[model samples]
Target chain A: MKLLLKKGRLLDPTLGIDFIGDLLIEEGKIKGFGREIEISEKDLEIIDCRGKLVFPGLVDIHVHLREPGEEWKEDIESGTRAALYGGVLRVACMPNTKPVNDAPEVTSYILKRAREKASVKVYPIAAITKGQEGKELAEFGRLKKAGAVAVSDDGKWVADSSLMKRALLYAKNFDLPVISHCEDPKLSFRGQINEGKLSARLGLKGIPASAETVAVVRDLLLARETGTPLHLAHLSVKENLPFLRWAKEEGIPFTAETCPHYFTFTEKEVEGYNTNAKVNPPLRTEEDVEAIKEALKEGLIEVIASDHAPHSPLEKEVEFELASFGMIGVQFLLPLSFNLVREGLLSELKLLQYLITNPSKVLKIEPPSFKEGAPAEVVIFDPEERYLVTEDFIQSKSKNTPLLGRELKGRVKTVILEKRIIHL
Target chain B: MRHLLDIYSLSSETIKEILELSENLKEILERPIPKVPTLRGKLVLLLFYEPSTRTKFSFERACKVLSADTMSFSAKGSSLEKGETILDTVKNLYALGVNLVVIRHNLSGTPHFLAKHLKIPVVNAGDGIHEHPTQALLDMLTVKEKLGTLAGLKVAIVGDIKHSRVAHSDILGFQKMGSTVYVTGPAHLLPEPKEAEFFEIRPGGFKICYKMEEALRDADVVIALRIQRERHGEPFIPTLQEYAENFGLTPRHLELIKEGALLMHPGPINWGVELSYEMEKYPFQVILEQVENGVAVRMAVLLRLLSGD
Candidate 1:
């Protein structure tokens, strides 16, 4: 099958292509993308993408596809569908799902399920520790052999420094990257929201920023000592900035990431006991958000991923202290991140690099490109389409987010993965 | 007009309106029948999620005094445990033709949540440590009845300001009426100024007193809040003895206040802990007047909310 996307503003940060062009696809492979592509084949399909921005499909390294258990919240099929709606073509599923992806069999099972049902590519991130108990390390070689892209005990931070050091060094031996959740359990125990005056006023216990920064410092030191590739996930606090800066200056083999919420919302969202705004490493202050944006612009924070942890109403519609952490964002990830461009904080190319290229680099995969012979995975989006984010707009099974009822600035128009084309 | 969720949002005009109505309602409470036909056909539902005998009875009495038939729903073992959300429960009540809901939830902003969905008025009896608007109003009414005016008064709220919703609403309510509010407790029990400032209605703002004497200094009204016993484990106060000895209202401490300063305490008080036992009988301690004013103030609030005046 041949497919054609005509007259779109092609934006491939990986190939440094930014021009009005036509992208041609033949047999699920990119034929070419440039100005006025010479295509005279009578059987070729054409799509007019005028006034649309086309780019390589986004790659998000942090998403929770709650399969093997808790399918009621989200499964691989539903999660990837949500991702596709946001112009994401690939996602690395976190291993905090039911039964936990701690074994090679579970990792293989996830991949098999993804292969059969997922709308977009799914990279199963296996747990670094057996059952994510933070007690014993999992078999890294076997997990890697089973097609796990990376290893993380994501929902729970690996608290023991010695165990974390061993996990990082052992994963390094298997050429696998170690991702740290970066939180101190002791400091954050029973914490409902950000530790500040807001929590104090709401009569809710607070999770201090030191809960993340202390853990970040520990993992960075261990990563330096072990010479293993380490990626910090969903950094929300400005206090982590100095430590991350020092690590980069010292040439430490580590990369830090921040989710869209870290830059978009502040602890003020948690006011009035809004459970949708409740998340782990709780939404921080405006100063921290500004710092996160500055870090991303300066390239100190290199990747942006949707830490899209979905929960059913059973978990979300409760008292503030009782409600579970996390707000689903896989579907709105692209539109929310586009605000960085609207604010002149990041160029379109730089934002795409963070969304597409940097995530691929973090997972050690070849960045999705618009080059010839590459698989035809692309997205067409309208950067200026304004729409109210209602529950029906979400493709995910769960609608737990503060963004609901908000008028968001961008919208995904279409997604092309392999031979399939989905229009939204 | 739709709900009394918190005193912070209540306009000075609306607050004065509620207070003035309560002054008239006080005369009705003094009458033998103590009942009115104002809301004879209306229905009021008391949905108490937490165990609160005093607040529930207060609202019930207020509804009865206004001739509104009242029903109470204790959420201790209801459909709420069967995974029913607070919204669903309130919606079910609304469907049942209830005129207004008096909600005392353990979570802050629950009445606000109910008010957003329900067409009927919602009155916040108390919501977590966030606010207790009526209690603040009744306290203010009691003070105004005794102290002439609230504008130039110096009001001090003592004990567990961080955990007391009454203290939060009272501080904001009293400050809004042009009174300077002073708050004092152990550093841990005293609210952080930022949280207090968020709810402040006036520019002059409120004060956080380091010493109990500092809070009591020339105060026209002194309000005591119950030091929550559940907070005992966290070392907020090392011991009840230590708390009472250092911060509790004793006769000796009364000397620091103005000669005729009115004393207030929202009932179900931790007797002898926040207030001295003998001080309860003191002429200045208007604890019972606070209770009497509660019914009158709630009657006024129900009338204003239901009548939409």
Candidate 2:
């Protein structure tokens, strides 16, 4: 069977193509695309894509599927469905789940479940250390062979410098990427929000920006010394920028990622004790937000990921300090990142590169593009569309975002995956 | 006036009204029969998630003076200790036809959380280090009773200002009432002034006095807060002796203040830590009067919130 997508603005950051064109799909693979494709097949299914932006589906390098445990919050089926609604066709799940994804068995379990239940592709990121205890490193070779894309101790940092150094060198032998969750637990101990006047006024303990910068500096030095390519996850503070710049200038191989919440909100979001705005490496000051946007624009920060930590109201609907950190973000990743383009920080294509191309490169996978014989992982997005973020709008089982009841521009109109066309 | 949550949001006129009501209530406390039938049928729930002796007693006495039924629920031997959430426990209490909730918890914004979820008026007894509205009101009442006015008074709050909910409330309350609030303590015990500047609700910010004498000089009132020895584990202060020597108030310091200036402590004061034991014997010391005023001020709050007076 053949399908024709007629007259849409196609954006392929990988192929560096941006123009209004028609795309053809045959047997669930991209057949060909040009200004106009003349298809004379009577059995061809044609979809009108006027006034829409068509692009390769997004690749989010950080997400939490919460599978094999905590299924009540989110599992592979529900999480991938959320990703599909957000126009992301590929995601790398973090290892900070219940029982922690450290061993090959957990990694294999995630992959097997994803193959059975997920609508989108799922890449399991195994823990860097056994049980994420930060003392002993996990078996990197076995985990990589079990289909794990990378290793990370995401919820906690590898506090021991020697242990982290060993893990960096050890993961290198297996050709596995090392993702570091940069934070000093001692500095951020019992911290609720960004350490500043807000935390002081609110009377909650503060997590100083030094907590992230200190960890970042250590990780960068380790990566430089070990010569292992490192991926820093969900960096939220401005103080880390100078260190990141210094590392880049020193020719250190590293990729830095910042989430939408880091650029979109600040500590002020927790002004009324908003639990949904509480996150680890907590939301920082307005200056930090500006610095993150500038970093993205300057290409110093190459990837924009959704650290989509899902927590039910059981964890969120309590006292601000007692409430768990993080908000569900996978579903809002694209629309929120699109605001970067709207604010003129980055062009639409460049924003797409951060969302799609850069994240794919971090995971060491081929990005989805409109090449012949490539899988038809495409998305139709309506940039002008506006919708309110409500419980029903979120496909994730947990609705724990500060954006709830707020209207957002841009939405996923349709997603074309191999053998299925899902309209959202 | 539905909830006595924090002094930061209380207006100058509102604070004056509570003080005036407290003045009238203090007169009733002097009566042979202090009991009033105004809120005889109302039930005030004292849900203290944290251990508190004075705050709970003050609220209970206020309830008794107003003739309102009181029910006390401490965290020990309660559903809270059995892994039940504070929200669920509060909701269960609210379902029992409780009229008003006076909550104190270890976490900041606990009262705010209950106030958001509950329909009946919720009073913040004390929530973490965030606020103690009634305590601040009572402190304001004590000062006004002695000074006759809250406006234009120089008030100095000394010791453990960073962790003192009373200090947090007093700074905002006094500033709202037109007092220039000055705070001095161990450097680590003092909160950054920039943090308070972010609070737009504050009528004016407090002054951070690095030297105790700077805060005490010519001040109309001086409040010494209890320094928690438990905080030593966190490196806030080197030792209680060091804090007392450097920041504590004594009779010798009295000469630095105005002739008729009063010394206040949101007791139980750390006798030798925040204030010298000799401070209690001084004629200017009004520690007992502050406790007396606590009942009256809380009565004013309960009456205003419950009877809509």
Candidate 3:
């Protein structure tokens, strides 16, 4: 349908456009913007976005929608609706499912379901090996050709150096980016949270940052040797952030993404609140959070994916040692992110680049834009909207979101995907 | 499943099940082809940081009964003497994919730490003076073998209770299974735990005659605890002459008790200080039976817990 978003403050960072004008849409493409545009009689709808700022829809390359194999927690329909509600138009789902999602068939199954039921586009990341066992590499070329976006062995690491080097070289042959969740099992055994005063006080096992840093150091050397494009997911351990900084300064063809919780919450949150704040990289101290925030502001972190790992409430309500490893984030990703920019912790330009340009580049896509004749995928949000992020407000099937009870500024007012108004 | 880490972590039901299952294993032990295929594909590594001849041999024999392989390592000339962290050494051993580890250490509560750190099961042969619960279980097995029951028998666990893991584990298991348990030792050796109902201290000379007469009067079961000489900074007994007179149980001392007062000790014993050399082979003395029961008790626990049945 033809629609016009009139008189909005347009900040399309992709085109470096900041103007107050009407954006005309036709056939799911931006027909014109920033000038007085006469709409055709065939124009279907026009809305006044008087004080809103229109932006290019954000893309997240690391998300777990729990589809195909385990849908009791979330399906493609519900998860994508929540994504649209949060102003995310494209999301790449991780492929650690019931059957490990190692083959081309599972990857194609995920793509077909996403096409049939999801409001937004979905890209499935295939497992690095058969059953993600890290024993042998999967058919990366066939999986990628079957629409798997990238390769990852998410829940576990590919430990054997020789096997990982081969997987990296094989993915390189297929031009598939290798995403690694770097963790050394021996170093991380029995560790419940970050090793520090807090973990000691609670009598929980301590996970040292060395567990993360050593893995990062190994991968960095592998990336350097193989000349393969490696992406680090949920970079929390502060010592590893410096390597990403080094990777950039040395012009290594590598990239990394840090989650919002790594910058927003610290290990102290898990100190008294119990298991809800517990996660895999295990939260770190305020010093680490400050380093992540500084890194995000400095452009060392290429993307800020939510890493939205959803789990059932029963899974998290048990003993701290027994609870699951992830927290849901998609429903509150936008407001929590915009709060960072509004609070002056991050400049608007940095936020835009992290949410849009960097992820587009990481996923090797034609960068999204709000320019004339571009795809009409945009997010209009109010910078001053105030609300408390609570379970009552979230649209996801699971209530494992860490943002619950957090008061934040800003809200996505409208989402225009394919000339369709999917949100309000 | 092949390891027995601690007694407390093993449930009462598991203990009872193992004791009952031992009746079946006894006949098999007498056969020429005594081995079974239960653990044919498995391997056990008995690594000890402390001295243990009884438990070490029993575990190795138990592995043979199940037709499994065994590798025993002591601290005498191993890499551990070169100062490697226990976690590192264990991880390296685990890399070799060893299925089970039987560990005995000199520190109290060391088994719990190992259990938490390792993915595999760790059997605590003995950990300091805290627990030798399996030893206690086997001791009970020996007593039950002669007496044919464990109901309301007054069992006095005499001598050095504080320095005795066997005594500590026995006092609890005995009381749990319908036996009146008591701790009899010099007040210095068995100091009352500020508040306890199980002990009555005899803070003076426990000469062989006097202590035996007191312990023998109406006792249905008399368990003489082994005095660990290494625990004492000074002489544990004032004099060997004085200890022989006071705490030692000779043949004459045994005559003061009832006809059959079921004599027991966790052996590798001092025949003179605790029991006379002849008393060690007394018909009712079932010391070896306890060692045999240890494996059966451990197997019941391993099967119940790991099988999730």
Candidate 4:
């Protein structure tokens, strides 16, 4: 297969390149990309990319593809398809599925399913604790050998400090990255949204910022003490910032991640008890959103992840307190994150780095690139495009989002992954 | 007009309209024959998931006054005990040609959930610790009857503001009517103002007065909320005795307020817990008046919703 993308402004932050160019792909490999490309080969496909911005396909390190158990909500095939439509070509799925991915067999099962059914690349992050109970550490070496890229207890935090320290040390020994969910369950007990005056008025129990910050502090301290590389996932509140800064200044090996929802929405989204906006480390205050945006701009926060938790109406269409805590986000990852650049907080290249390069670096994977011999994984988008975020537009099976019926800027126009092409 | 889920969404004008309607309904309640033909053919269902006597009776009596037939469902022997969802149960009610549902559940936003699912009108009798719109309206009605108007009154709500749905609704209701609400209780018992702001009742206007003396000082009205015994679970309050002594209203505390400041309680009040037992029959006490106003206020709500106003 040979293809040519012509006259698009290519942005490859990895290659330090941002210019109007033509990219050539032959047999699933990037042959070349430059201001002018000479093609001698006949029978080559061409994609006219006029008035478009092209970048290496986005990489999202946090997504929950509820396979091996909860396929009704989402599976590898549907999740990867949603990610593909969102311009995300690589996804590292959390290991919180039922019959949890704490064992090598589950990790291998995910990889095998991805190989057979996924539209995009899928990396499985196995559970740090066996069954994610936070009691005993899993076989890190075995999980890594079985195709797990990282280990995390993403849904439940490793509440036991000594146990978490041992897991971090063990992961370091095995050269696997440790991801902490960072929540003190005790403080978050029966909590529904961000602890504040709103929760008091709404009468929904609140999960205070201290629940996250206290846990984050403990994990950062453990990471520093144990000398393990830790990746914090789906950080929401401003309270986590000072500690994150302290950790960074103290030369702690850590990468903090926040999702698009953290920057795009606030605790007010849960008003009228809209369960679709309900999520763990619940959408925070405006100050937190501002701080998160500033952290992204200042590079204090290194990665932007989807943290795409999917749930059916069975989980959401009930009373607010009874409803499950999550919203489907895999499909909105790129479009929402693009708001950072559109708002002039970060350049397009810098934003793309958070979406693509930084996540790859955190997981220690081969970064998606627009260089020769690299896989031709690319996404073409129009930042000027605006569309109503209707249920029909969502590729995921679950249409649970606060953004439903709302207008959102930026849309992915095309995706080229190796030998395949998907047009939106 | 579609639903009375909570007081948070009602504007000040709408609140006055409800109060005025309640005032008109109060005349009907005093009539020898109390029944009205307003909702002659309507079927209203009383779906109470939580145990309630006053709210349930108030709603039932209001439905009777409006000439609407009522069917009651308590969670104890109902299919809800058999694991039937609130939606499924409400769907069953709707299938029975029920025109409206007056639901009281122990979960916040249960009415919102039903309103989203059901086509018929839904009135929130009470939903968990979220809000009791009619109760707030009735409290406002009592205030209006005693003070001539709700505006320009300093309304102090004392007791478990954190857990009392009445406090949540009353604060919003009073604030909407240009009344400055001072919510006083123990720091643990006092609700965080975030919930108040969710109703667009911002701070500075609405005060969280942890000191009862300060909250009661020169207050035009003081409504004592029932201190829920279950909320006594620690770190919340050390003991009921401590809560009653420190935050509870007494005859001595009453002197701190305006000379004729009306004292109110959303009863089934725990006597001697939130207010002294001696103040129960005090001339300024409007606890009984609140009950009467509850039925009147609920009648107005039912009539408004059924009339599609």
Predicted complex 1: CAPRI docking category: acceptable
Which candidate ranks first by TM-score, i.e. highest? 2
lDDT of 2 by residue, A169-205 (tens): 9988988999999999988878889988888778888
Clashing pairs in 4: A197-B193, A197-B194, A197-B195, A198-B194, A198-B195, A201-B195
CAPRI quality of model 2: medium
**Model 3 per-residue lDDT tens digits across residues B1-309:** 434655544555666666677656666677898777777767677878889888888778777777767888888888878976566677788788777787787655556556656787777778765578668777777677778876677777777766677776676666656676655666656633421322222222121222446656666778887777775545557766566556666677666656787888787787777776778766666666666776665554333333331
TM per prediction:
0.91, 0.97, 0.59, 0.94
Separate DockQ for every predicted complex: 0.28, 0.64, 0.02, 0.56
Clashes of 4: 6
Q: What are the per-residue Cα lDDT tens digits for candidate 4 across B156-259?
A: 88888888899889888988888889988877667655555654474555887767888889999999888766633346767779877887788888679998
Q: Per-residue lDDT for B1-309 in model 2, tens only?
A: 778788777888999998898888888899999988989889999998787889899999999989999998988899877899888998899899899999988889988899889999999988887889898999989998899988899999998887888988898888888888988888767875546564324444578889889999999999989875543346677777887888888889998999989999887767888888888888878988899999999999998999973
- Residue A8 in model 3: lDDT: 83
Angstrom error at residue A400, model 1:
3.1
Q: lDDT per model, in order?
A: 0.87, 0.89, 0.74, 0.88
Residue A226 lDDT, candidate 2, scale 0-100: 98
* Model 4 segments more than 4 A misplaced: B193-204, B229-235, B281-283
CA displacement after TM-score superposition, residue A74 of candidate 2 (Å):
0.7
Candidate maximizing DockQ: 2
Model 1: residues with Cα > 4 Å off, grouped in runs:
A1-7, A19-24, A31-39, A46-51, A139-141, A160-162, A184-208, A266-274, A317-321, A386-392, A405-407, A421-424, B81-83, B231-235
Q: Distance from true position, residue A239, model 2, in Å?
A: 2.1
Question: A1-424 in candidate 4: lDDT tens per residue?
Answer: 7999999999998887999989998998899998988786677989999889999999999999999899999999999999998999999999999889989999999999999999999999999999999899898999999999999999799999999999988887778999999999988988889988678767788898889999999999998998889999999888888888899899999999999999999988988789999999899989999999988877889799989989998888888889988888888898899889878999989998899888999899889998899988999998889899898898888888999999988889999988888898
lDDT tens string, model 3, A1-424? 7888888887776787777888878888988786566667764788788888788888888888888777878888888887887788889898888776789898888888998999888888999989999898999989988998789998788888889889888988888889889888777876678876554333345587888888887887788889998888888977877787787887777788888888778887774335567788888988898888877777777688888887775666543565788877766677777767766877665687788888878777766787768888888888778888787777777778556787867788888887578656
